[model samples]
Target: MPTYPAFRIHQDAQGHHAGIEQLPRPTPAAGEVLIRVGWSGVNYKDALAGTGRGKILRTFPLVGGADAAGVVEQSAHPCYQNGEAVVVTGWGLTHDHDGGFAGYLCCPAEWLVPIPDGLDPRRAGIFGTAGLTAALAVHRMLVNGQEPGLGPILVTGASGGVGAMAVAILARLGFSVSAVSGKPELTDWLRHLGAAEVLPREALAGATRPLEKARWGGAVDNVGGELLAQITRTIAPGGNIAAIGLVGGHELHTTVMPFILRGASLLGCNSVDIPYPLRRTLWNHLASDWQPPDLEALVSETVALEGLPPVFEDMLAGRTHGRVLVAL
Candidate 1:
């Protein structure tokens, strides 16, 4: 058996720890495929899993990466074959199963999506889970009747991975975007990403009202808690809010006014465990018209497997922006 490098997370009497180790390369099982991982991406959930902050892991002593793009090296599944490029995100990766932080990964074939034409492994890693979630959120909003002329779309946590991607995609789709971020330094960057207006994080702060002046046609909120509550109350009639993350907090204090009076809807965006068919549809769209215009600008840094620990720390501290691609 060939020994390959992997980054593993372990929990012991002392506490949780993550580091690189040499392990035997894995082989595909009956319905799985083995891939030589070329690139992986860092996500907030991956940071939580690696740092033992959130209970994101169903099991310890496992490889820790939530998004991977690579080439298939072996396969026992009919849908995939050797030399084919594929990408994997969510589907309990870095949670219940070993994930992409290894030189090689063996995962169920159903979890794999072929890398779209014109997208390389490195570019796929830039999109990873964040881009996928953004695409799904936008898709749901459109299905619920959101359109470019409806009104401006508000994206909370605008400098974060999902928020940044949402801003870019919505702008590309011809919708005006209002981005909210605490970092004033990101104003120019957010604008460059196509945000027509950049608002301070405090713009969503303060007391909550049963209803506020209608502001947005739709919203993509990555921050929960009070911010989400504020967004819900401020949506225009018949608009939708795609709730994606809970980085701010989870408790939602609001009334039925938005739903009953304004006819607003809160669509929970869960990228994990999406039906394979929908996954394919979304990936195809992302590779085409919905793709970010400047992917390299969204990537703040790229690190190797051994450098992931510090990157996770920076992410948890809110010191990092955009995506962090991991080169295996």
Candidate 2:
């Protein structure tokens, strides 16, 4: 049997654990394609799955990566051919099925999106799930009528993967961005990603008001709970707020005054279940105009399969910086 290296997660008497191992080659079922993965990325959910905090693994002994870019080694479908470049992300990856951390990947042809022209596999993996989610959030906000002339846009958790991408993309689209983060050390980095201003995390912390001073024209919020409530309250009249993550907390405490009085909108973003065609369209944009000028600056580092465990720990502790790409 053909052999390849993979990072596999296993449960034991001590608890869950993960590491690199040599595995038998994967076979693609009909309608599926087999890819020789060139690069993958570490995500927040992947960190959770690697540990046991988020219950992200529906099956144990699973490969753990949500994003991958590579070349198709074999295909059983008409839409794709051998030696084509492709990307795979979302839709039960690293959860219900084996995922991208392995050297080889097998998934349905429909799950694969062609690596757009001018985009290489490594850069595609750099963007990975984080960039895709950021693009989707921005698209939804614009569709909901967020315009460049609306006023300053706010991005919470602005040092993170999603936050960094959101800031860069929003700035590229011509909106001024006010980035909110607790990490004072990331100020320079946030500005490099195109944030117009940086706000201290305390700015959104422990607020009791149902409504605060209306500040942002619109906002991309990656922190839930009080922060989300703050965004809803502080957003300008007729503005949009894209709600994405729950890193701060899950429980949100606030009145409906902002939504009812200002006509503000709270848009929930779930990138995982997005339709395939829409995801592909986003990839096209990422490779073209929507691609950030400083996309490479967002990557903290690229690690090998064995380095994932420590990286996962740092991510869970909120101690890591931007994206972490895994070199297969």
Candidate 3:
């Protein structure tokens, strides 16, 4: 069997370690397709899995890319054909199964989303899981009665991949976007990405009131803990908040006053395990009107497989911004 370079995570008596290694190339099994990966992206979960900071991987000795875009090299599944363009997000790519931090990937065909017209593999990978989650969050907010005319939408963690994409998408959809970020230097960048206003992280810091001044008409919250609690309390009546990440903390301390008195809704957004139909719909939207303008601006850096170690370190340390595309 031929061999290929792959980034794998392993554990032993010493400690958990992840690095690039030569591994046998994978072949398509029943209901599977072999993909020649062109691009992948570094997400927060990928950082956790690669660095062994969080128990993100269900198994060891696994590749650690949660998002991949490429061309199909072979297919044992009836739906996929050779040379087809496709992208995969979530679906346990870096958890229980071999992932796309490699030259090739063999995954279930049903997990693949065909790259829609006007979107290439590289751009799709740039969007990747983070972009998908952002789009999903916005979608859920809209479904829950959010609209451009409602009021300004707030996006927390605005400098991160998901938050940045959320801001751009919401702005493109004609919503006034208010972004919150800890990095003061990124204020201009956030506004350039379509944020009507940029607020410091302290805006949501500290203890949150059960209910406060009605501010945001809707919000896409990537930071949990006290930040989420504050957002929930401040949302306008009947507004929705899509809670997407727990980077701050997981424990949500708040009362039901926002829900009972103000009729606020907290919508949990999960990109992982989203059904194929909805995934396709979201991807299609991304490839269409929801696509951010000047996506190249969102890419903070592009690195090769061998460079993933430092990238993961930067992500975990909060030293990186926007999306980091990995060219395989």
Steric clash pairs (candidate 2): none
**What C-alpha root-mean-square deviation, in Å, does candidate 3 show against the real structure?**
1.1
How many clashing residue pairs appear in each of the predictions shown?
0, 0, 0
**TM-score for each predicted model, relative to the true structure:** 0.98, 0.97, 0.98
**Model 3: per-residue lDDT, tens digit, 115-207?**
999799999998999999999998898888898776899999999999999999999899999999999999999999999999998876544
1-328 per-residue lDDT for model 1 (tens digits): 7989999999988799888899998778899999999999999988999989989888878899998899999999999989999999999799999889989999999999999886888888899999999999999999999987768999999999999999999999999999999999999999999999999988766647899888899999999988899999899999999999898799999999999998999999999988999999999988898987887889988999978989999999999998899998
Pairs that collide, model 3:
none
> Candidate 2 versus the native: TM-score?
0.97
Model 1, TM vs. native: 0.98
1 versus 2: better lDDT goes to = 1
Native-referenced Cα lDDT, model 2:
0.89
Residue 308 in candidate 1, Cα distance off native in Å: 0.8
Worst 10 residues of 1 by lDDT: 200-209
